[model samples]
Target: MPSSLSIAAFAAPLIQLAAAHGYVSGVTVNGGSWVDGSNPNWYYQPEGTAPDTPGWKALNQDNGFVSPDAYDTNDIACHKSATPGETYITASAGDTLTLYWNTWPDTHHGPVLNYLAECSGECTAATADGLSFTKISEAGLLSGSNPGTWATDTLIANNFTADVIIPGSLAAGNYVLRHEIIALHSAASANGAQSYPQCLNIQVGGSGSTALPAGEPATDFYSSADPGILFSLYTAFTSYTIPGPDVWTA
Candidate 1:
């Protein structure tokens, strides 16, 4: 599928795009339809007025991001001051989730990662605290030097959308999906990396028997000095090591 990106070769930068750092605008469950999965306006809604979906709300105002300086706080878990989703997405064990972002800047070269955490009960009641996440999907530095073609670049080429697969062998349960993109545009400096993570709840029901894999807390996922987190995209690099724990596949 990387061949789809060849169009980017003869037609990049010159597109004269009105770029902006973006957020999850919609999500498609099982490739069926699009829904406003992430309630972007949860902060401004009157009490109990937010849209009911698996997507949680955070303080990522104006498509803002959480800096590495706040990596130690819960803000790093989702976004700044995130709250749990009020509902859950009804999905099976092996479903494909399509995440659509509002926009992503071409200058923001970085990796894309997704993590999964199981919840004992309904995930709506689950918070970022005490949650452990195992990397499920990640891609970075797909090819070439000159900083390489990153996952974020692919997302931009695909109209700011990404697809993640749910482990087919996963056991029936409630879980939270943490999807993130680390923009390394200014990551050359310490604490200059911008982390934009969004969380959503999922109710998976199937006969598969694999249990949730062991995971690490989001706060412990990365350090400001990590090679991937504190990187300079301006340099030429053929390979990039995406930060966070090894991906868990069932």
Candidate 2:
């Protein structure tokens, strides 16, 4: 029922968003130099296979995302067929880390969250599936209507960068840092949400004695029928509940 110009205008942004699928290009700890376990130079295309990085490599080389239809599958753990990184980055509790995304479309707005799962031993050799993840950080609807000032908006305002703070009370160990962004631009319909989750292997060192518990697996992270996952942003809304377990605190 829309005119040609109206349809074109509407499709323009969607096309842009599709062409600019995102990926974690690099990460910095305590405001240090940027480092990436995977390809740091991912643009229109990704470079040759990454040699080493604390960040796990997902199948989103084309900057693609995982839809809600795959919620119950192992693909939701990290991205899709995610492979563990060969090494990890060292950091201490209470350290702030910045995750850099290659690009993010403002049109795609939703929630941003982080989770941590400690490995039995060396995380470098750990697998993506079956890890118990505990929510550590979450930023949902910040303010305004049309889900205004969302975490994704703030991320865009900050040049496609998201900051995550390591829990100060977490025990020293090898862990997997899972950072995710849920794009709810088309969430009005079923299976419309787009999930962009990535992982990083971190060797944490601190005197804190609180070891992360064996939390719920990533498959139980969300359900297709969840209020947050099946939400709508096309209309006005005042509040938004982040979909997932409560964040683990000291």
Per-model TM values vs. the true structure: 0.89, 0.88
Give candidate 1 misplaced runs (Cα > 4 Å): 1-19
Give the Cα lDDT of each candidate: 0.80, 0.80
**69-158 per-residue lDDT for model 1 (tens digits):** 888888888787787888777778898988877667888888999999998687788778868998999998888766678899899887
Worst 10 residues of 2 by lDDT: 1-10
Q: Which regions of candidate 2 are displaced past 4 Å?
A: 1-18, 40-49
Worst 10 residues of 1 by lDDT: 9-18
Q: What is the lDDT of residue 206 in candidate 1?
A: 81
What is the TM-score (0 to 1) of candidate 2?
0.88
Please provide, for model 2 over 1-250, each residue's C-alpha lDDT reduced to its tens digit, 9 standing for 90 to 100.
Answer: 2333443343343345556657666788887876764542322344554366787877665567788899888888888888788788889999998887766788898999999999988887788775889999899998887757899988877767899999999889898999999998888899998898889999899897887877888988888888888998978887888999998876
Which RMSD values do the candidates have, in order?
5.6, 7.5
Alpha carbon deviation, residue 42, candidate 2 (Å):
7.8
